[model samples]
Target: MDNHDLKEDPRLPYRATSRMEVVDVPTIAFLAATGEGDPNTSPLYADVVEALYASSYGVRAVAIEELGRKHTVAPLEGRWWADDLRVFSARDKDAWHWQMMIAQPPWVTVDVVTAGIERARSRRDLAEGGRVTFTTVTEGLAVQTLHVGPYDAEGPTIARMHDEFMPQHGYRPRGAHHEIYLSDARRTAPERLRTILRQPVEQSEPQS
Candidate 1:
């Protein structure tokens, strides 16, 4: 069976380095679920991840069997923020609010997602099954970089990106902090994990 890999697609900026770079991001669809708390220990976060992957793979199966098209399930992605954004700087993970998602190919529609959810439900019980929704996210202009290390060690890199890089480049944050998980934490060692960190941005106002 032929499989389409979105990660390798040139249209997406899945690649990044330790140095930040600006890029234009296009709109993309995803099967998403929102929750609050630390992903490391949150039961809701785990359920959301299970439901998202189940639905995503179910959609891929539908495409291959019913539509004669095949595609690989994309990596997990997330947008994170908090009621008090300072909580992030303070490393208060329990206070974090996040929308966890998996990118869906163009051919995967609402009907496909619905059918996939039903399929997943029949195969196994998914607590967040009904919560997953197909949605589009357009980040527009953004800056991104690759951080290769434990997630906990990302503070310094993120600090530089937000406090130093953006201002030096005439840009200001415009949206939630984003991350694309390229390596599975369960299987990859923390030091080797590759995560793409992105922040949507806009030109900063000129100083007086």
Candidate 2:
């Protein structure tokens, strides 16, 4: 083979675009703790995603599009509520798991998530097992921000969108406050981290 033939072009079939899109979606969701806040006792439900697809490795996912209606969260104190988002579950042959999720409904709250988990802890089936957890989610419309920075910095980006951008655009959060990390933090950098900050938003009033 000639030298030209020996040169293999490096290109991927799929190209990623650098842009953010707004969307509304209905989904079932799941919540997991990242050990960032208090564990087993903290009233914080931090991680949430739409449980869409599942496989041995994991599932493909996008930020939630919308947060839906509300329902009472049983097994929790003070009459908690949960949103109606779409969710799916899968268990790998090796018991490895992956979850693809939509955004949380506007009604889903941080308090509800941890409260649900604590309640699940009392359940015989959910406890005394491998990775047992309690989840709270709902379906509704959401606005997502694709941030290309360290996960730690995601808060500021979300703050800007919620505190400034969305309001400027005449939209307000209407769902559970949530986010998703597309990049592996173990090997990524603070400046090069790829994270998706998704927040459910709605117009102040019904649009005409």
Candidate 3:
């Protein structure tokens, strides 16, 4: 059986150059959990991460054993926002609200996800297990870039994208900020971490 991998799929906008690029994003399914607070200090964040990966791997096992198919689990991704956008620029981690997720293959269905949850539950108790749910996100027109450094350093890059690039190009930010973690933070050095930062946008209307 052929292995399905999201990074290698041309239809998906998985590749991003260091320079910002605008692209139209289609609807994509994800196993997601939403929470608030700093990921480094929040217990909820840790629990959600554990639950997401457990469920994802469980689903992969089921696919291989029962359906005769295999797939590489996609990397972690996030949708971030807050009551005040300034909080992000100021690095106020406590005020952040985020949905942490992992992209699932197109063939994965509700039943498959449920079975995967069951499999994870059987192996170990996941406190946030119930919070993990299947969701589809349609970001539409978006601008993205590859950020290679510590997550904290992304502030300047994001500022440029939102305050300069978007406005200069006649685009307006429309949705929550997004990110794809291409490198495992636990094992990768902070300076070498690869994160894809994306923001949904819409064309600005002409002046009256």
Top-lDDT candidate index: 3
lDDT of 1 by residue, 88-189 (tens): 566789989999999988888788888887888889899988889989999999999999998888888888888999999999988799999999999999
Candidate numbers, best lDDT first, in rank order:
3, 1, 2
Which residue runs of candidate 3 sit more than 4 Å off their true CA positions?
none
Better model by TM-score: candidate 1 vs candidate 3: 3
Model 3, global lDDT: 0.92
Residue-level lDDT tens digits of model 3 in 1-208: 8999998889899999899899989899999999999998999999999999999999888878878889999999999998877676677899999999999989888888889889998998999999999999999999999999999999999988999899999999887999999999999999999999999999999879
Error of 3 at 198 (Å): 0.2
Q: What are the Cα lDDT values of the candidates?
A: 0.90, 0.37, 0.92
lDDT score, candidate 2: 0.37
For 1-208, candidate 2 gives per-residue lDDT tens digits of 1111101212210111234345554443344322222222332221221111111001111111122333221111111112322110111112212222322223445554444434434442332222323354443666665678754444456556666777777887674544455555557777886555566677777568
Top TM-score prediction, candidate number = 3
What TM-score fits each model?
Answer: 0.97, 0.44, 0.97
Off by over 4 Å in 2: 1-20, 29-136, 206-208
| Backbone Cα, N, C clashes tallied per candidate | 0, 30, 0
